[model samples]
Target: MATVDRSTLAGRRDAAALLLGYACAARVSELVALDIADVRETPEGLLVTIYRRKIKTFTEVAVPYGRIPASCPVRAVRDLLAAMAEAGHTSGPLLVRITRHGHIAPPLTRGGKQIGDPHGRMTAEACAEIVGRIAAAAGLEGRWTGHSLRRGFATAARRAGATLERIGRHGGWKDGSTALLGYLEEGDRWTDNPVTGL
Candidate 1:
């Protein structure tokens, strides 16, 4: 199974992006398109608003998990926010730019200002590349892409004893079957255990 360890990444932005993708079980497009305003901390947990480009609908998701490892999704998000604050980002897109040379920079406006770029969201291809790089750095082997993070989350959640109903709700799926077939295919490994037939 391919798992993401945010620590393996060289930059905070990369780590944060990977964590957001994994924890939210969100598409890379959603992750990169997310803005600081899209995140709202509620008493229940963190509420993330996902704007669907295809459907032209907004899906509000609540992440219930708390801080786990240093690379844990929640902690990683906190770290990402802190880094953004340090970079003088008060409100704007959550994920910014990280060059191939490992330099992190904010998106520039059309006027050439350093203000965050509304149109500078990462592409799906870039998202996939980021996932592949993180997986390789973490020593995981599998066919991984940006979609893998969402699949990985569903798979891991199910293996950890989360029911289909719960997983489905968490993923905002209309039905358990949809969640299983669409997002949690990796969880099928559990059904393949030789001991199960014994």
Candidate 2:
């Protein structure tokens, strides 16, 4: 079946993580380190705070509720939050350990003491694995990782004619970065060079 049973809490959270990762061009560590406190609604859109390891600083970015409902990060995140709230989760890690059976139950039953994720925060390895798994399922061949999302962002943005400076800032790269140099897709956007046209 092409249908997904998003009625399940685990399913909702997974979908949210996947969509948010792509929309934000997130690093795996950043995605797993996310907390309920890091997300908020601003006048512009849904704001996501990403803590960069290289700079050791937090940067907030916005993800629009795209026209496509199925792939919308904003809607996915909102749905996940609602599901978590219903389960008595007010705060803590946004990414959690999903059991083999797809349950998000706390690991400990004694006194209902639940540490964030109970099973513990989702590891970067797990995050990468999920990205690859989802890609394969979508019929995409070749290896994919958490970094793949960032690379995909750069390639797509470049192809769409977004400036390198804007792409660097969006990816949280240091100023005047060549970080995007290797991520460019094979193409010449200026073949119809605007300067020549002018």
Candidate 3:
């Protein structure tokens, strides 16, 4: 996020998206589906309500403040909200597409013409593309999609000594998920390797 220039609206929004998405361990669909009204600020952190299509239910994800102010998800969200409000959008989509010229793109009609709706939420594809674009900008070699945030969250949390059950809950994974267990195994490999301390 340090590489991203927050001086522009697009940059600010991108930073917020990346931070919030990772902090919430959200799928791309859940991340993009969020609205300004879905996030509530608390004294400790943020409470984000996301609808899970897989389970067909709404779940709340708690995102606490980061130790670093620059990389803080809470701060990023607050900054984005302030910028959005200044741009006359106090509600609606939390993440919207901004043109190269920095104006929020209006919604398009089925006829491909711009519609009256000023708050045009970004598509899941666009959000994933943004993740890849930012990673490339940072000179990262591996493929980086929106799912990377979810995986990265699991890996990081495990490394930080978070329990599997807690990690799974944070990521909205089903109980005893094989996919969630895979991350725990991966996390352990690094610390438990026989090659370590060699």
Candidate 4:
């Protein structure tokens, strides 16, 4: 599935966006705000540094290489950056804008200041659209939005018995326990359900 996306400019871009967004629990703004320089390779995994108003200084998060190579965030970002550099992009926003007509090519400069070219930092709406497109392409029959990644991550982690503090830190939320409990409590019904210890 992901192998096919690596075949084109937009495919690679969207693939990287999906995997990285899911793995990092990134907000759409934080996702699109990334630059080529924000990613660096580490001995264990790739470190992505995000600088947002909420996180005044900067935050570095490690994204490991998953067993599935095609779905690995580290590989996806590395490949995307390599493709971008090969296309002459040495700087600027990590995600280049794609047109409504679905065109992807190499015209963006380091800062995407090329005249009349729209390949630049993507908008939040565009990010949502990409997530929807990726979901549909993967044969998911329902609607999905940019927040799905974060939501899905929280659900998956809770199911794996991750503590609220761990989940909050992983998601870059200083105090997300209240919000997470709402999502988790419903699934954690073993304590109240009669089926437990039966």
Candidate 5:
């Protein structure tokens, strides 16, 4: 029952991360590494260009949400862009810095030019920590991770009556089966259970 509540700053950031993860169905690493230019508003919804080192491929994916609204992923992207602009960042990486003091800041290049930080992009460890912190803040109890956000979206969308084919396509899976597998395996385990449903 780890739902994202976008009220506080941390909550908003965590919600932004969750929404990005789910909307793109992106791996946490990819989600964190995303650059400002990588996202664009589309007539259909949003288009996200993903680069994965392990996959060694660039993927163009679309997230179909009704248009770019204030509450949508586009807003998150805009906020990030604004933050970067405020920090005088023009390019390089995206996720920025995760300070030991728990503060998030922009990264700088060797020449002291403002640059985005790839190191702060959501890693498995960072994802785990964020999930735990968000869960605790929301007063929810359960195992959670970056993968949970993606799985939650699939599962919740399916339970809300979204078609598997639609979810699969939006999630950028090669097939409905693959999407369904993650949806069922990772999502259903939490939502479908008799107890602790969100």
Candidate 6:
């Protein structure tokens, strides 16, 4: 997140997307489907509404202020919103494609031809590609996909002493989910290992 340049709108957008996604433990699909109105500022922090495609329902994710100001999700989102508003994009998709020349991409249209996805919003693939690009730019050597944010959130929360129920609820994982347990176990692997000091 610190690697992202705050001076540029594109950079701010990327940072906000990544931070918010991680903070909310949201899937890429839910992250990209977000509209400006879906995220609201609260006294404590942010209230984000995520649409679960599989469940056909919406879930509210709470994102509180971070202890570290530099890595705060709330600050990142506020900065992005301010930048977008200055660019005359006060509404519509929270994340959209920015052209090489540094302008928002126009809405897609099918001029008498059939188009599968006609909306101008960013796709899940595009979001993943952005994640990869940012990771590479940061000189991180790993296969970083958009899903990495969610996984990181789970691990970080677990390592920070968050309970399984809280982690599952925040990440929208079902109770007693094996996948959730896997992430928690992985988070615990380095700390207080059975083989440590043996």
Candidate 6 per-residue lDDT, tens place, 82-169, comes to: 9888889888899888777777776565786754344356888888887889899889997899988888899888877788888988
Candidate 5: regions farther than 4 A off = 1-13, 43-45, 52-57, 64-71, 100-122, 176-179, 185-198
Global Cα lDDT for candidate 6: 0.84
Q: How do the predictions measure up, each by TM-score?
A: 0.75, 0.83, 0.90, 0.80, 0.67, 0.89
- Those runs of model 4 whose alpha carbons end farther than 4 Å from true positions after fitting are 1-4, 52-57, 99-119, 183-198
lDDT tens digits by residue: candidate 5, 81-109? 56556557656545555454435553446
Overall lDDT per candidate, in order of appearance? 0.69, 0.77, 0.88, 0.76, 0.62, 0.84
TM-score of 5: 0.67
Best by TM-score: 3
Which candidate number has the best lDDT?
3
Candidate 3 residue runs with Cα over 4 Å from true position: 110-118, 183-190, 194-198
lDDT of 1 at 118: 48
Better of 3 and 5 by lDDT: 3
Pairs that collide, model 4: none
| Candidate 5 clash figure, as a count | 1
Cα lDDT of model 3 by residue, 48-114, tens digit: 9998777688889999999999999999999999998998888899999898899777676768776
By lDDT: ranked, best first: 3, 6, 2, 4, 1, 5
Task: Name the 10 consecutive residues with the lowest summed lDDT in model 2.
Answer: 1-10
* Model 4, span 1-198: residue lDDT tens: 443457777778888888888888787778888888898888777888876445565678788888889788888888888877887777888888755444444455567557533446777778888898777877888669998887877777776777788887877777655766664534656644648668
The residue ranges of model 2 lying beyond 4 angstroms of the native Cα positions read 1-5, 107-119, 188-198
Better of 3 and 6 by lDDT: 3
Cα TM-score of candidate 4: 0.80
